[model samples]
Target: MPVPTTRDKNPASILIEADKCSGCGLCVNVCKDFGLEIVNNKVHQSDKALFGCIACGHCMMVCPTDVIAIEGRTLSPVLMFELPEKSQAADYESLLAMFKRRRSIREFKNKAVEKEKIEKILEAAQTAPMGIPPSDVHVLVLENKKQVRLFAEDFSNYLKGLRWMSSRWFLALIRPFLKKENNEMMHDFVKPLFDVYVDDMDKGNNWINYDAPLAMYFYGSPYADPADPIIAATYAMLAGESLGLGTCMLGAVHPFIQNGKKASAFRERWGIKYPSREGLVVIFGYPAVHYQKGVKRTFAHIHRVS
Candidate 1:
């Protein structure tokens, strides 16, 4: 049976042009599912496929000739395009420079990101790899500062209803079920964060999203892998950096808006279609401040297997 997603239930249809096939085996080599094989020196659909055609489009993309057409599961041969030349891609130094110069920017100039730039950011994000084809990631875009601030205000109001979650009684009640680090974080970081988000926004301090000119909340359907939206959001962030826009990832809003009637209502109000296990909100804008130097950072640990 085909893997089910929120969008489609059936597997893709794989059509092969036997007359055009050169039997080069490029498509066969790339298709790990063993969906296609050479028979009598012509490509043919094989019964050995594990999940049928996932509509990954890898076979069609790799074919030397226009021999394969993948249809269904939101994919088609028409969707294929010419790949950009390798020279057009950024070199290691340029990529590292962009990464190093990037930082979490909350202070933004009172300027809106251009519509073209916003579209480009999304286009780049669509190229991100996913756990499955026909990626389940969805994005909610707040196109300007007014919408962003309004969303923050509404979210702050919603947080008011969830203030009980940060209470001492609730913490004590839930502490035993949580791991030590999680328990400490719930008491320390999360509790204070809830208060700060609700309280500060009430006083006209827009820390919820820092009043950025543009914001995109990337999330997935219940059927999606938890990392799908996160990976897409990261791609969007990198795209923002490439476009000279400042960006910041706001993690606090996601967990709060995930599990209850109040949360469901809040989601419905904002057009969020489903409650996913993980999601992220990224704000983008022209930065008000400029950095003089890039800071070096490191991972917690990096140990290769012996």
Candidate 2:
């Protein structure tokens, strides 16, 4: 039977093989949407579904007998993979060590990132969890240093065109609407960032993307969750680190290129899909320098209810 969702016009098809059904009830227990139930001691679609099936695949994934299959809305049973052995997984200490080794590397070597490494990074990023089952994230890959530099130059010029936004009069006009903290941020941080990006670029300095060998901009469609692209970009960064490539996340480019006619034109030229709520740019390259020690970092605070 097919169950429709709010996002998909056509319902997703769920097939249940009666002979292979073990009736363990794991699938029924894991289905958050109440889309599945036991019918005469066998798994079946529940008629009392809240919003029909979202096709999140919990039912299929949890089934011990592989009796259930889902198809539609970019999901397919064919895409299923065998879970890796527990022994193959990384320990907490190893993960923490890798995290400590990762730094925001702005300085890069003259060497270019291998194509295989870039592909592997993208592959790992695709495995990141998304807000929805089928990801709406899009990645724009600038393969080499030349391409990255060209884009940064173009972006700097674009920012220069809108320099009036950083003016004192403009900040004053928007202060009342923006509130105190944001107003101060505009004057203190954002205005200075704009100045440095534009001014430094004029003197052949690239503060935008840092002239890395490779850069990836991850963005989302109108239907995508704001965090989807960011999570994917983070995954890409971690993958780059694992591959021995230096990486840095550039957040300044996204918000600046999200509005106005000129921004739209720039997006069109670059094949960027939508003016996403959130996006991220990560640059990767061989390291030009190495650090002997890592600094410890802490959160602002951690609250415990208990």
Candidate 3:
């Protein structure tokens, strides 16, 4: 279903042949502004938001089998955005308005998101594309904060004591002039969730992951290459954004889990097999804040040698 803008008017009467409809209700689900609804396993014209339909045609794209007809027939037809016969300043102005509207949100309202909504976001994540063809990747969705905390704590313990190598051995063997890295690394040593984003993680005050509501972990298989898990995790994050959810990538924990003695323990607790070193973790939550405006960015220079 395409959203009909001012330049593109909605056909007087668009018809959907119920007989061809699979009752998937993708049109209703995808077009939230249109207020389309699924009733009795069929799509019912929603009187609530019919006027707001932008006719973006997303509904037509999501339909699995041919079912919806825009104008009068059941066959998929070519829908085009009508351009003015003559150029006008208003057209470009409107286009810029739409382009400037999207912004990445960091803050979120205190309102708790429903579990069903979170599940929907996960469903979208599952649909994300993979880098390799049918590669081995495991996606773990941390639905609860406690689970995420446990994973973080377990990872933190794994990281403990390992810093002695970089702090003591490397410094002693290599150039003595190099600044003491152990102290800095230990200071930076975060107890997984406790240290990823939060500034304070002491017993009394804890702000790890900035009190995020959920986390998602991506684990690669032993048989797959190291980059496989990372690519999958990246896909999941993009999918999260499409669902209007906030995400943050947590990288430190994965390294600790792979090289430390606690690695086996963490793997057993999560019931996940230790893959290659490429395991990745990411946090997802309803943002505690929002950004109404986009920050300015520096332009990058590119050259094509060929």
All candidates in order of TM-score, best leading: 1, 2, 3
lDDT of 2 by residue, 111-172 (tens): 99999999999999999998765678899999999999999999999988899999989988
Q: Give the lDDT ranking, best first.
A: 1, 2, 3
Report the lDDT tens digits of candidate 3 across residue range 208-249: 344456777777765555676776676666656655677767
Find the candidate with the highest lDDT and give its number.
Answer: 1
Candidate 1: segments with Cα more than 4 A from true spot: none
Assess every candidate by TM-score: 0.98, 0.95, 0.52
Candidate 2: pairs in clash: none
> What is the C-alpha lDDT profile of model 1 across 35-56, one tens digit per residue?
8888888899999999988899
Estimate the Cα RMSD of every predicted model relative to the unseen true structure: 1.0, 2.1, 15.5
In angstroms, give how far residue 153 of model 2 lies from its true place: 0.8
Q: Which residue ranges in model 3 land beyond 4 Å of their true spot?
A: 1-113, 163-170, 173-200, 204-208, 296-303
